[model samples]
Each structure stands twice: as C-alpha cells, then as structure tokens.
Target: LDVPCKVVITAPEGEDPHPRFGKVEMSHAKHRNVSCVSCHHMFDGCGDFQKCADCHIDRDDRSYERGFYKAWHSESEISCRGCHKAMKAKNEQTGPIGCLQGCHEAAQK
Candidate 1:
C-alpha cells in the first residue's frame, strides 16, 4: 500500500513455506515513486491478481516483442531499463542495471 512496505507471504506453521509458490515479498524500492495502479492496471476498487503472462503471451516467439517482456521493457512508460536509465541520468545510482545483467537472472541459464 505504501513505499518500502514489507508484504510477508507466509504458510501454515508446520507446512512448507512454499506449498505451491515460494515466499514472495513485493519490494517498493524499484517502484518507490510509482503507484500500485500503474502496474495493477486492472484494479478498480477490487479485482483478482493476474500474472503478467496471463496477458503477455509469447505469440510470435520473439523475446523482444513478447508481451511480458514488452510490458516491462519496451516503449512503455514503466520499462525497467528506461526508468533506471533516467534515474542514472539524474545521478541516482541505479548501478549496472540491464535486462540480462540484472532482472532476469534465469535467462542466463
């Protein structure tokens, strides 16, 4: 609900922390000045949480044009690199951020 908030995702006391998905903590550092509605665009008072892949499907099999990739890295206003670059220009110290070198670590494998 606010910047720098810690959203703890927990499971039952004895159960595995990740019965299905692992623990998730939504950080606000990257999006400190951004509003929740910017990313959760479908939220209108109340709505279900939809995964990025739900709408950003790999239709043409092109990594650059893929919905999920484009959604966060293309010409969109909220692109990660775009914002980081801007921050860097402002001397905000967004050190060495890039698609391959930063966010998507699994892609390296």
Candidate 2:
C-alpha cells in the first residue's frame, strides 16, 4: 500500500472521497495530484486501473513466471513511472518513450 506516502491530503469529515480521488484534481494539478495513468487508462474520459493479474493469468502466454506482483511491482513497490524514469536516458538513445511521455503525455496547459 502506497498510503500516506502519496495519499496527499485526507478528506475532512463527510466532505466526499470521489473529488479527492477523481481525475479533476490530477488533470488540473501535479505532485499533489497523483497521475495514476501508469497503471490505468482513460477511455471515453473514464479512468480504469485494472490490476495486472486480470489479464496476466498462468494460461496467458505473456504471463511472467514470477507472478503479477513481481512483474508489476518489481522487486520493491516502485511505481511504474519510477521504473520508466530509471530507464529514461537509455530509452532516449533507443527512441523509446520516457517517463514524461509514458504518463503525462498531455502537457499541462
């Protein structure tokens, strides 16, 4: 659980959790707004972060031997962006997308 570390501000009593967890904040802000796109996708303005295991079952050819947790979380609980950023420079030379492109593709304007 990446709680407290990145949960940012907690909701006041009965304030509504949806606004606090919804895309409006992330779309309009950064840092204080956590971009969840690394593990999620927005389709028709709907955000979905289906866990990796749903698609990566043992019967699947692309399934990893170590399991979804290992494949997705790496050895530690590093976010997907963290892994992408770790390879940003090397990916630059290879012409692959870096962390910036991988997640925050839409530049804040």
Candidate 3:
C-alpha cells in the first residue's frame, strides 16, 4: 500500500468537533524512516487504516487516555509532539515543539 506523501492534519471532528488551530501539512517523507505503526498504533497490520478521530475524541466523558488533545500532545513518544521532543533531546533533526513554530504556523518546510 502507498503511504500518503503529505497529509493535512487537523483535529478529528468527533461528535463535538472542538475548537482547534489551523490544519498542518505533514510530509510523510519527512518521517520516511519511522514505522507506520509508530503513529497508526491502532492498526492491526490488516484492513484499512483507521482515522485517529475514530477513537480519540473530544466528548465530555472522554478520559485523558482517549482524549484527542492527549493523542497529539501526550508525554508518550508516539505522539507528534512527543516524537519531536525525543528527536530534539538527542540533537537529531526534528520539527518545532511550540505553538507558533510548527503546527500552528502558516506553513512548514
């Protein structure tokens, strides 16, 4: 199967589509070396890829473990922010970890 070359990532519009910043274009090429399971952890190596919003939601009854915000910004290393932080810790090439620097920026390289 062909992975997406780029993806415009935004908050999954769960039943209550909470407020969020602008969509961020993610280049899969930028993460070519990373395993797909690293981000698509929910996938079972079969069937279609499940959208992140499929489980992580913004419902009022959601737990921190399943919250959409936690899915992106959690301390877990698989998250976009978490991965970036890990790379930066090792002085490896990585994206920004701030609001106005990467995800919320007008554009990324």
All candidates' lDDT scores? 0.53, 0.35, 0.76
Between 1 and 3, whose TM-score is larger? 3
Q: What order do candidates take by TM-score, descending?
A: 3, 1, 2
lDDT of 3 by residue, 3-52 (tens): 77998767555343234456777898988899999999988889888777
TM-score of each: 0.51, 0.27, 0.81
Best by TM-score: 3
- Each prediction's total of clashing residue pairs, residues at least 3 apart in sequence or on different chains, is 0, 0, 0
Look at candidate 2 and give me any clashing residue pairs.
Answer: none
Worst 10 residues of 2 by lDDT: 20-29
Candidate 1 pairs with clashing backbones: none
Candidate 2 achieves a global lDDT of 0.35
Q: Order the numbered candidates by lDDT, best leading.
A: 3, 1, 2
| Model 2 stretches with alpha carbons more than 4 Å out | 1-34, 41-44, 59-70, 73-109
Q: How far is each candidate from the true structure, as Cα RMSD in Å?
A: 7.8, 13.7, 3.3
Winner by lDDT: 3
Stretches of candidate 3 exceeding 4 Å from the true structure: 14-20, 59-63, 107-109
